[model samples]
Target: MNLLKSLLIVVIGILPFVVNAQSNNYKVRKCFGYQRDSCTTSANIFYKLNEDSRSALFVKGQSSQTIVSIYNGRDYRISLCWDHILGNRMGFKILDRETKNVLYDNSTDEFATDFEFTVTQSRDIIVELSIPGESTLSKSEGNEELIIIRKDKEMGCVGVLIEHMITPTKGF
Candidate 1:
């Protein structure tokens, strides 16, 4: 009985470590073919939206803020994708890092899945990703509910894909 109890305790202690190892391995798998890519069908659609840009991945419920340089007179397509298990709850926002002015907010825009815009000036912009709390958000400042989704202790992956739009030249 004593030996059986000891073995059971040992297995239970090591179970978490084993599970964590498997999850870590899954995260680093070549399933996406790249670190910034996604393996889901929905994500594949976004990947085809633009060819000049690549995608970046993050864990669900965790916020990611990135500073990117936007060139003047250039159009960019920014898309967001989650594990698909999380549904359409994933959203992102673009803000002028210096002025804190919101360049784009998906939540207010009917939970838009993507955005396309042309910048007039070259500047550093902040891209933020979050799991929205409310099903719908209105255009009111300081009254939005910012909720994080905790689907599981080991949350799945989310991706942000940015593609630069090619402008047609005047040459004929």
Candidate 2:
């Protein structure tokens, strides 16, 4: 009985780590899409695994945000990608941390998949993601309700790709 109890405790403790490891792999795959190496070569400022700006899981119609520091005089390319199975409706926005000003909203730009810009000052900015809700439709020529659902649970992996925009050196 004591041995069983010990094994049970060990399994319970390791469960979360295993789940998270799987999630990270899924998220990374989703991020790069068909071009796995694109993310690596493009991102000079990659976020660490399980870090604030790395990845997240969310259901449809949910919104989440993270803060990442941006340096002055350096341009950045902020890109967002999600589980392709979930469709292309996922996107993110950039907000100024201190004043809360609306810096960039993807929705306003027709849900752009990526954004590039240079910050004048160094500070933390909020990166907010939005996932559209699942669509529901009434059955045609039938009284039964029709609902579309994924084979897997309604969870999505969002990856924020942060790439540094290198500047060209000017000859004096």
Clashes of each: 0, 0
TM-score for each model: 0.57, 0.59
RMSD of 2: 10.5
lDDT of 2 by residue, 41-72 (tens): 34444422222336555566667788888878
TM-score of 2: 0.59
Q: Please state every model's RMSD to the true fold in angstroms.
A: 9.4, 10.5
Cα lDDT tens digits for candidate 1, 1-172: 9999999999999999896554346556522533244522223332234332334434434466877877786777776665544455766789999999998888899887777776778998898877543222222245656844343432555656676644434579
Off by over 4 Å in 2: 1-53, 134-153, 169-172
Query: Against the true structure, whose TM-score is highest?
Result: 2
| TM-score between model 1 and native | 0.57
Where does model 1 exceed 4 Å of error?
Answer: 1-60, 133-154, 169-172
Cα lDDT for residue 115, model 1? Answer: 79
lDDT of each: 0.60, 0.65
